[model samples]
Target: MPTRRRTLLLIAAALGLPRAGAAPEGGYRFQRGLMGTRFMVTCYHEEGELVGKAVAAAFAEADRINEAASDYIADSELLSIGKVPPGTPVRVSPLLFGLLEEAWAQAEKTGGLFDPTVGPLTRLWRESRRRKALPDAATLAKAKAAIGWKKLVLDPAESTATFTVPDMRLDLGGIAKGQAADRMLAILGKHGVPCSSVTAGGDVRMGDPPPGKEGWNIGVRNRDVDRNAAELVLRNKAVSTSGDLRQFIEIGGVRYSHIVDPATGLGLTRPVSATIIAVNAATSDALATACCIADRETGRKLAAAQGAEVFLAEG
Candidate 1:
């Protein structure tokens, strides 16, 4: 393969939406961090009495849902699902079942291009990164074969997840952000907050738009080559981009992007960057990765067909 320039997915998160001034009140300082990202929920209620109760309940719910969906911990229900014996009928929470359904939907829509079962490949890359050495083609193929979204089975009535293939596995990173956004929005609504915003790392959800602020002004970085200068703004939506150049290996005039192609099981040689703005954060994240991995022209076409506004910095 002639050395192809690997593209980097340049993503930006902006919550610059404007609305009426925030009501003057003291909302609880709701804060927590997990999976290397911080979540903050701030809201005001009409009845002061409900704020505390609502927040407390919401936090508890968030914690429970997070525990069930997170892939970072070994004991998380997700890891258990991926590691447990197939067809064992392990129980899963309602929220987790919802997340799984959404993930499966995305996988189907993206034609398996936005696979959540990419955990094994991601881990192998992580190991290679730690060792500061690239995996041989054979090792990459081994890990790739072990990863596939199609190999997982879901039962809606039973709320059970099973791995059809012994080595098949999943990681919920793509769906977690959107789930968090949805949960936070639910909490905000429950607390009677007319408007609010929730941002966890790059995933952002807005209730009404911070008092007097226009729609959130999201900024897209120009690869590792530029700074905050290049930004894109959208209204009432979330944007996500996947980049390969961010942390990649450049060997012998060949660049290996971190955004692995599900079909090839190898880092993409094309350096296409995709920016997708959609109704929710999870969709944006998944589409961003899928488009970048699919490369520029074809990925952009797929994104457009999905009703997501697409922006590309073709590599």
Candidate 2:
């Protein structure tokens, strides 16, 4: 929504030569614009035609998820849920249901620090950034009143979602990309390409090592792109970074990040960046956001509790 902030994490091509038994076509990299950002899938396969099809399938899956989860889309499934009256159960696709379940679980885990129901506040923040002004107290209170993890109920048995309060909305900006990346990687694996990586905006999900390489090289960029970046070698894992580095606005000389704090009903005032590494992108993506909302010590504990690692920097 905010011009798709440049990802703090960058992928560096592995330096190793192709190993024995590797595909003769070497590797393939495909890119498509989706979900307000560039979605890329890099894979190794025996047949070039298969690789193209696989990438197309993966991008199609991303488009499906975006149409369902995107808040910016006028007719998105997410918006449809808000159109119904309070207490009405809205049947959702299994994919949307699964993503809501993950987001809900993370919200509970973070004690509401990472909430998908903060759509009201997000809307206000987006407008605030555009106008370079903060919302009035009354308006801010109204938006905050409509946000709470408990207000939205997910019924897995029925694959339905119910809202207990009026004017409630859903925003999956934090976790949808990760879920899409995970699904894309799975799709690639199904196409006989077990060694692959999917980058959806800031979320990166990778499977297996590239040919002979031990792992993919991921470079975590600093606030100053001119500075040296920290790199990590990882495989069969996922990493995500959330921060105010690029997506921020200055109002009345105060810097406001795009990430909203549910407790305050406003964008975070501090300069913070959080990168999380976990078994999958969904976990890492949600954790990275929660990490940014918390202090460094609490952020580390939050990641640790989820069996993830956090690299948090605050100023």
The lDDT of each candidate is 0.65, 0.84
> TM-scores of the models, in the given order?
0.78, 0.91
lDDT of 1 by residue, 63-150 (tens): 7767887767778888887666665666788888888889988888889888888877777666755666677888887778777777
Number of the top TM-score candidate: 2
Q: For candidate 2, give the lDDT of residue 12.
A: 17
Per residue, candidate 2 scores C-alpha lDDT tens digits across 22-56 of 22235766666778787777787656556656666
Single out the weakest 10-residue window by summed lDDT for candidate 2. 1-10
